[model samples]
Target: MGAADSVTACLSKGVGALVGTIIAGSKSFIAKAKILRKTLGSGMRQVGVLCAPALFTLEENKAKILAEGLNKIKGLKVDTASVQTNIVYSDILKSSNITETHLCNILEAHRVLTMPKGPFKLRLVIHHQISESDVKYTLSCIQKAVNGFIG
Candidate 1:
């Protein structure tokens, strides 16, 4: 396998292991919760509040939105090779003429949101509050701002 494939495989395995651990631990906790519920009369009430289904649904929806938005950006590249779970790794070339801080400022000014992971790296995420239009607008704004800065 090539370098990208190797990295992808490694990340996939690592993420799988981590997720397995979390699942096993959660099951263990559920057993304890069951015992506590019977002893404290808080079984159904507390478990209902957790809402694991809703949380998982939200996670899936957010991932879909993010994938759509990331594809919309022209110059920014997405590296799907190393992505295993919701976490995505991408790279921005130094020649892009776009500083990470400039992008951050543009997003902030537009009231959109993102996080910078490196000097040339940016991370945009989707959650309940963000929409597709917001992603498009943020990308347009970043393009305009970077062009203006370069000019």
Candidate 2:
């Protein structure tokens, strides 16, 4: 083949490979989605509500709020040396008398939210449903609950 024809052939082959790869990837993604929907018993549902646009907007701002709230806690320390994610973990060694259930109840009463990681560890998660003020209020509630439990 001539030089120009060789270059054209190479370009056509590259484009063909790219198209094939994209088609295969799409098929794989569709298959995975089908399997997940069946497993979750959502195959019959025509509409799925993962999150609305407003909730998506809230989710985009959740990380900063979580970081600020985690910082406000006194003895509860977080690993901030690395890039932080949406979850916050704190050690409860200072509040030995505070049970996980009690902490959960205190959070419930304050309309905050948290979960236990272990005997002396607690985990907090920030989501689109929670606001920055909620985080601050939760920290305050935790502080008070811990003090009351210790005393």
Candidate 3:
């Protein structure tokens, strides 16, 4: 970050940090921020408990695992190379005879969660807690759902 640049990032949802954010910037910005923090009485204690898992999440390759599995499923298109993070976007093909919402519902019935981005686009997020086995199960469920829709 530049001398004038300041950034605030939330660690609650993706990294599994239930609460907390990181505020960082140049020395001048930090000096001003500290005074503001003191004025606002914003103090924290024992934050390492949440920070540890967030750190762990950064080191994980769970998103790649899920993205590769998604690429193998028929009637879906996933550019695995574009998966640089924990989010995977899959486009449902016309051959699948399935709408995004319908497919999302089917996956949800199988205890898998996904979000529909559009009529034929689905969004899946890989979190720190999702395991390889979970990815396999999710893939199996999606393959079955797509095949059922086409057949």
lDDT tens string, model 1, 102-136?
Answer: 77776687776668898788776544344557656
TM-scores, all models, native as reference: 0.54, 0.50, 0.75
With candidate 1 superimposed using the best TM-score fit, by how many Å does residue 133's alpha carbon deviate from the native?
A: 2.8
* Residue pairs in clash, model 3: none
**Winner by lDDT:** 3
Clashes of 1: 0
For all candidates in order, the CA lDDT equals 0.53, 0.56, 0.81
In model 2, what are the clashing residue pairs, if there are any?
none
What C-alpha lDDT, on a 0 to 100 scale, does residue 125 get in candidate 2? 67
Models, CA RMSD each:
8.5, 14.5, 3.4
By TM-score: ranked, best first: 3, 1, 2
User: Model 3 misses residue 117 by how many Å?
Assistant: 1.6
lDDT tens digits, residue span 69-109, model 3: 87788889999898765788999999878889988888998
TM-score of 2: 0.50
Per-residue lDDT of model 2, residues 1-151, tens digit only? 4433111122112221111111123556767756976798865432324223333433465555555555556655566543143556676655446777677777777777688888767777665456667767776787787767422
In candidate 1, which residue ranges exceed 4 Å CA deviation? 1-22, 25-60, 80-90, 143-151
Best by TM-score: 3
Q: Rate residue 131 of model 2 by lDDT.
A: 63
- Of 1 and 2, the candidate ahead on lDDT is 2
RMSD of candidate 2 to true structure, Å:
14.5
